[model samples]
Structures are given as structure tokens and as C-alpha cells.
Target: MTWTLKLVNRQPMKEKLGLLVQHALKSGVAAGHLRPTEIPLSIALETPRIAAHGDYSTNVAMTMAATQKRAPREVARIIIDHIDDSGHLLSKTEVAGPGFINFFITQEKWYEVLKTIHDEYEAYGACQIGLGKRVQIEFVSANPTGPLHVGHGRCAAVGDTLAAILEAAGYQVEKEYYVNDSGRQIHTLGRSVFLRCRQILGDAIEFPADFYQGDYIEDLARLLVDREGAHLPDMDEEEAVGICARFAAEEILSGIRKDLEAFGVSFDRWFSEQALYDSEAVRSVIQDLKSRDIIYEHEGALWFRTQDFGDEKDRVVVRANGQTTYFASDIAYHKDKFERKFDRIIDIWGADHHGYIPRVSASIQAMGYDEKQCRIILVQLVNLLRGGSPVAMSTRAGEFVTLRQVVDEVGRDAARFLFLLRHYDSPLDFDLELAKKESNENPVYYVQYVHARISNIIKKAEERGYKHMCWHDDFTDLIKLPEEIQLIKLMARYPEVVAQSALLMEPHRIPFYLKELAAAFHAYYHDRNKHMVVSDDAGLSAARLFLVSAIRIIISTGLTLMGVSAPETM
Candidate 1:
């Protein structure tokens, strides 16, 4: 069947109206009246956070007035006159509050949205803005020197969730981790492990203050002794450190993958810094830069004139010590990512690495690519709280708790949910005891309880013979409840939620949206006994049953994206 025919059977009214507004606004611009380079069509349909204003409101007229040379009210009136929303979804459009167009969709349209919830459940909350293009998302590329801490945990969750959101919106997305094995830090890691190996061999080696002090280092020492021998025959510290670093990296990376797996974070690939060097991509990229005249030598060190491309300062591509800088390897790595045919590449880095953003973009643009094609999502630090006191996490003292330790103490569900509780850019304060609490006071438990309650509702429906009743339009009277309409309206907005999360690179929005949806289910459940599903009417019960099932599916879909559980029974 043709797409137009297919859409006629299924597309939601909100999507159609959004398209009309976009087309109409651009048509207004083409008619020699307005211009829209500064603002987009989306700002014109943003709903006020305070629900009393309207269903959705926008300030398109205000945005276009500078080009129209007319008042925003006049622009809004002209646009409204051109709009043909025969459906009551556009019940009224008025210019209000400083050139804003406020639109109130009708109650009947909101009620009709229930049919959309069920009709599109399999492909329910999806968008096609990506146009089937492949995107690569690299995140939590921490050094494999030790276990990941709570701070790294945030990036892992954010990156993985963003990938899920993009995939849901029909993008072919790949999740990757950049392994920093070929760096000076790995040499330092080797030295730290070898010290532990010496201690295991009964040698009185003085531990350096900067050495890794985690118990895992001692475990690596034991592994080396068990696999090799008790006595070292005149081996230099450098050779021993090399062995230790190699062994430590393998063990630590294995443990890192296991920890992320337990947290439901999986990657499609683990790209290596060493691999770039081995493939000679690094040398090829450096040669390409030299051909472009962006590379130069000053005081025996090679530099890239990144300042010319918008970086704050020139960056060293190679230090005077004959070793290339990490920044250079990064440029090569990003070039490889782009050359692999991904339309977009997203890098999720820790907030501490915020300074690296400008140089990376400058390098990308200097290599003849648009700076906008590269995106870096910087996640703020995660403050760990246990019993209300801040848990001191010092890597120098080896006092940092591993991601696995956090998961063991609390759980995968609690850790995953809490990591995604805030905006991706906002600093997350993760409380351990609060996460483990089984009471309704725990936010994770509170959200999961709603899912469980709805599961119970489904069982009650079956016990009341709803299992045999065919779900059709005739039994939609129960969905006519005010609360039922509210729930449907929330579900109807899921596609937009997914789209926003992907475009803004904020996957935490998914968890927040899930919480709001679960809140609706909880409020409805709290009123279940009093609200009376029976209502002395069969149609009411059927309609309520349909709405409850719809909510359960949406909640499950959202929680799954975050790797959190949707328990059938609390």
C-alpha cells in the first residue's frame, strides 16, 4: 500500500497538525512577508508547563514579526486564517500574552487519542526524523585501569539510553566504547599493578602514593603469581610493568563489561586507540592535515592551528617527547567514525572533560566536515550519598567504589533508575540507602508499583470475564472518564517525547516522562476502589480496561529503554 493510504488508516492528529503548521509558516515566509532563520517551527507549538494555559501554545508570530514588518498578532491572525483544522483538535487559536498563539484541542479529540494508543502499540512511540540514517554514539570511554566509579556510571547510563531513544525513533544506531589502552595512563597502570605483583612475590617494594590502591590490583597480583612463578629472574621494572599492564587491562576490561552488562548497558563495539595506530589511520590523518597546511612545527612540537577553526587556542598534535597527543588520536578516531558512513556521531564525555569540546569540533571542521555533525554530550558529576553523607571517592587513595560495588549494594534497577533521574547535563546526587529502601518512599519503587497495580487490574479484568470480551469501539465508554482521558493524552504524547529526547541528546527525559505516566496510573489506581470500575455499566469497565492495558505497555516500553524493571507485582 502507498504511504498516504497507510497514514490515512493510522497517523495521529498531533503529527498532522504539526506538519501543517511547519508548511504553513514556511509558506508565509515564501509569500514575501516573513523569514525564519533564527527560530524553528517547533518553538511555535510548545505547550506551557502550567496546564491551565492550553494543550499546546507557541510564539511563531513573535518569531516572524521581524521579517513580516508587522505586529506578531497580525502574523498569528494571518496564519490562523490559512489553517484548515476541520478536526476539533484545533478548537480555538488565539493570540495571547505578547504575541503567543495558544491552541486548545477539544476533549473529544483527547478521548479519540485512546484509539491511537492501542492502534500503534507495536510502533507506538516512534518517529522517522532520522530517515533510517545510521548514527554512532560513543560513551563512558573510561581508561581500563580500574573499575568504573559512580561518575562514569552516569555516562554509561546516559549514552546507552540515548542510543535506545535514537533507535526507537528509527535511526540505525551503534553504541561504542573508546578504549584508551594505547596511552601514557596505561603505562602508569602497569607500574601500579607491578608494585602489587612485587608485594605478592614477597618483595618489599615501596608503593607509590599515586599507585592504584583498589583491592582489584591485589587480585591481579595473585593472578600473575598463579599463572607465572614465585621467583623473577633478573627482569627489569619496565618489562615487569609491561606484563602487569597487559594482564591488568584484560582483567579490568572484562570486569567492566560484566558490570555494564549487569546494568543492562551493552555496546555494539569497543573501539581501541591502539587499533587506530595499528591500522595507520593516525599517520594517514596527520598526513592529510599536513597537506591542508593546518599542521606546523614550533619548538620541535607539531601543532594544529585550531584557533583559526574556532578553538580557544592552538592545540599540540604531538608533544616534543616524540609521542602523539591524545587530541591527535581523537581526531583520527572521529575521522574513522565519519568515514565509516555514519550521518552523525555523538560522544558522551564526563563533565570534567568539558574543555576538550572546542578542539574536537575544530579538528572535525578543519578536516572538511561540518562542526554541527559532531555532538558531544557532557554529563555532570554524580555525587554519591550513603545514609545522607557524601561518599568520598578518591582515585589517588584507591578509595573509589567500583560501579559493580554500587550495583551489588543497591541493585541494577535502583542504580540504573537513579542515574537517569535528572537531566543529562544536571549533576546527579545518587543516594544509596534511599535507592535500596523498599518503602513507597523510594522513587524507583514508587514508579514500579504503578506497573504492578495495572497488572493487577488486568488480572481483575480477566476474572470479570474481560478476557473473552473483544476490545472494540463500542466498549469505549469507560475511557470517557476524566482521569482516563488524562492518561490517554499523556500516552498520545510519547512519540514527541522520544523525538525530543533524541534530538536534544537527553535520554533522562525518558525516565522523567515514564515517571509522569506512572504517576497517572498510580493516581488512577488509588481511586480504583472508590471510582468503581463496575459503575453498573459494562461499557465503562471495558473502556477502563483498555486504558489500563494501554498504560501498562507504555510504562513497560519506557522503563525498558532505561534498563529498569517493570514489575508485574510489587
Candidate 2:
């Protein structure tokens, strides 16, 4: 169970391949096999699906074929001739399928991958490809009218995981939550609570069709009455509504924070929309736009020249009645983000906000900022189900299943893992029954079981008198089992998977990788007689134990990045 293995200093296999390819190409030029020119800037290396082909394959020869005025196969042959297998990184090089160079790595080199996994453990899949750039990820900016629903759960999972992956990739990342506390919805919430308060005081009043109709509003009203007492009924109606608005907003927002915290999502900052208006930042942004001739008065309203900047039509920043639009405050908020010097800003929004991207991007350009600096990731809907039937949800009527409720039902780990099982853009059907099941069909359990199974194996090994020090000892040559080799190959891909996920800002890849790793471990485990961990052969036993120990570390690492727990006993 000890994961604190000593560090093993080694270059990444992929980097070694790139270096080897470059050296061969240079040798080709030196021998006059090809024309002398600058080497290609990047050499792409990929794992072939068929293991017999090789450990890695590249099309660099095909790329050089046209430039060298020779067949791709001819180019591949010249490059292969110069490749040195003395380093034992590559056992042999093959020219396959129209000059695709395939590299068969030595088994000893693959053993080093397990050593790297053991050495890194928690930092196993981490990389520095981000180059320490600062990134801001804002998600689940739902209005603080009520508790977060299941859809917000999906956003929370994606955003939190993306931040973790980016940080793991050596980027300075900050998770943010935008609080929309200054909009028409806030006023409507105030009205809803005021009506509930009137009813609490035994007044006869009809509830408006447009007002919020949730029980939380009544709870806020009750809280207001408990604090203010009989004096509230005698106060001016508008004055009562104003006090109620601030009170209800704070209460609702407090609930939101609690729910997010329970779901394991926390933000570095809670930015308020009202702060923009209170500090006159919205007006300042509009003035800056006007100074740049990006705004003009049309129909007695200040209009942003959005149409000129690729919007379908001009957008009104300030209405004729002097009320600034929501779009105006958003522009100000994004401007504030840029002024704060974030190298990259990513917004995770609901799929319904797809149309909002163009106008926001246009506004960013109109204000003399690069539109590419801001990227919006639209998370599609989450369909909650029970026994193959859809669960009802409606944000407008406040009848949706709250994130807290979902977590309470199946626990936080299942909720997070299920939310991240698919790409953010694809709609997810979350079957409640399936998530709660304790069988292999349940993906969360299947992956977590792998970690627990490895722990049990190591525990059995110790119980059978095998010293824990055996894992730290050298046992590379003894680990040549077929299943063991396949397991090593899959585990070797973890660092690349993490780098790709971070580069693409996609957290779904982590869950996919974990599932694949779990399958490999399960396959290896099923052959108990062949790959026994506590065999009489000390060298083979130590090697199998070491392999399983590495698997345990990787499973824990992958689960941790996705904000899910890797249970030692599931």
C-alpha cells in the first residue's frame, strides 16, 4: 500500500523517440542519402492499435518523401538504416504500409515505465507543457435564485476537473464563480419573497404568475420575518422589497456555496454582478466603447456597433430609460478579467447560451481585445433517470433536482464520476439506479474496485511473508508475462493522456482512461494461476507485486484528478 517509491530519473519514451528520429534524419543528410535541408519542426509519434506492428509509429518518412523526391518507402529505409538500437530503447525498426516507420521498443525499456510510475506516483501523469501560463476557468454561474440543480452539477464537475488537470500540467489556474446578483431576476426574487412575507402576516394577496414559486422563497420570507418582526408590515412596500432582495440574495447564495462545497467544488473568487454597477465599471466600459466609436445612439438608446463587428445586429448597451442591459455588465466583467492579466480566460456555460458567445466575442473585439483570448465551453444538458425513465426538471418553476439531492442519493464520488463520463458538449443520460449499483456494470465501482483489488493483493502478499521491500528491489527481467506486458503498455500511456486532456481542456478523457486501465488490471487479475502474486518463485512474485503496486498508484492518481475518491475498500 506504500506509494512513496524512490524517484527514477529518466527521459520520457516519446521524447526519446523524437530525439532518435531526428538523429537518424541528420545521419541521412550527412551520408547524402537525401538532400541537405532543415529538419522537420515536429515529429508525430503514435501507438499502433495492433501490438505486433510496434510500440510507436510515425509518418515522418511520408512527409519527407515528397520533399526528397523519392518514394516514401525509400525514405523510410534510409532513416531506418541510421537508427541505432544500441541504447536498447528500440529493439528493431520496421518499414510498414507505404513508409510508416514503426519502432519496436525493448521490453527492458517498457519496464522503466513502471519504475517511472512508481517513482512519480501522485505526480505520475503530470507534465509541464502548459509552460506555467495562467488560466481562469469560470463555471456554474447560475443566478442565486435557488439551489444548484443536476445540470449545475455537470458544470461543476467539468470546471473543477479542468482546473485540476491544468494545474497538474504546470499551469497557474484559478477557479471562479460569477454571481449574478444585479439583474431583473433579483427583483423578481425580491417580489416573490415579499409576497410570501405578506401571506405570513395574514394579508390577502394574489401571487403573480411571473414571480418565483419555490418553497425556498417562503423560507427566506420566514427568515426575514424572524429577524425584522412586526415592523416589516408597516414599512413602505418598495423599501420592504429592497431589504428583502438583499436578504434573499444572500440566503440563496449561501445555500449555493454550501451545495457546491458539498459537491467538492470551490472557487478562488466569488465575483458579484452588482459590484460592477456599484463601482460604475459598467458606465466606464460604455464610455470607453463610445470613445472608440464602437457605440452610438440609436432609437434613443446607446447601441454597441455589434453588427459592424460580425453580430447579426447592433446591441443596445443602455436602454432609452437609462437602465444598462445585462450584456453591458457582462462586457464590463470580461473587460475586468482581461485587465487582471489572465493569459487565457475560459467560460463554461450551459448549452442554451450558445447564441451569447458571438455577441460577447464581438464586444471583446469592439473593445480592442483579441476575441481568441476568451473561449467558451458550452456544457450540454444532463438527463437524470431512474430505472430507464427520465426525471423531471424545470428551473423556471424551481422543480428541478438539486445537486445536493443527487449527491445525497448516490454520494459525491458517483455523482462526480458519472457527470464526467462523457464529453461536455454531449448530452448525458445519468441513470440514478445504475450509479447506485455496486456491480461491475457501474463504472465508478468497476474503476474503484481495481484500486481496492490491488491493495488486497499487496495485503495478501505481506500476509504470506513477502517483504514490502521486494517492490523497491529490482525485478525487471522477471516481469515478462503476456498480461503483464499488456498492462504495462496501457499504464505507460497515462502521462500522454494527461497532457492531451490538459491541452484540450477536456476532463472526460480521465474517466475513459481509468476505465481502460481498470479493464487491463481485471484481465491480468483473472489469470490468477499464471500471474500469481505470492508464488514460490521470489523474483516473479516480487515483480508481479511491483506491477500491481504501480497500477494502484495510477488508479488513485486518475481518480483524484477527476475529483472522485479512490476507495481502498469499495
- Top candidate when judged by TM-score against the true structure: 2
Q: Summarize candidate 1's per-residue lDDT along 1-570 as a digit string, tens digits.
A: 677755643555567667667766766666645554554646446757876667777777887888767898998877776666755467777778778777777776665566656767746787788889999999999889988998888888888888888998889999999998887878888888787877777789788877777888898888887887765324876888888888899889988999899878999999999999999998889888988889888899989989998888899998899889899899999888889988898988999999998899888898888778788888999889988999988887778878888999999888988898889788888888898999866778877787888788778777777664336666554456667767777887887888888878788788788888878777877775755554446677776767777887788888888888899987
| Stretches of model 1 off by over 4 angstroms after superposition | 1-6, 20-43, 48-53, 65-75, 91-100, 231-233, 291-293, 468-470, 534-537
lDDT per residue as tens, model 2, 1-570: 133222223456786788889898998899998788668976889999998789899999998888899999999999999886557788878999989999988888788888888767799889888899999999999998888989999999999999999999999999999999997888888889988998999999998878998788899999999998957768898898888898999999999999999999999999999999999999898998898889899888999888887889888898999888889999999999998899999999989899888889999987778889899999998999999999877767768788899999999999999999999989999988998999877899899999999888788888888876434436766887777888888888898889999989899999999999999888888887787777888777888888888999999999999889887776
TM-scores of all candidate predictions against the true structure: 0.91, 0.96
Task: Provide the lDDT at 3 for model 1.
Answer: 75
Model 1 lDDT on a 0 to 1 scale: 0.80
**Count of clashes, each model:** 0, 0
Sum up the clashes in candidate 1. Answer: 0
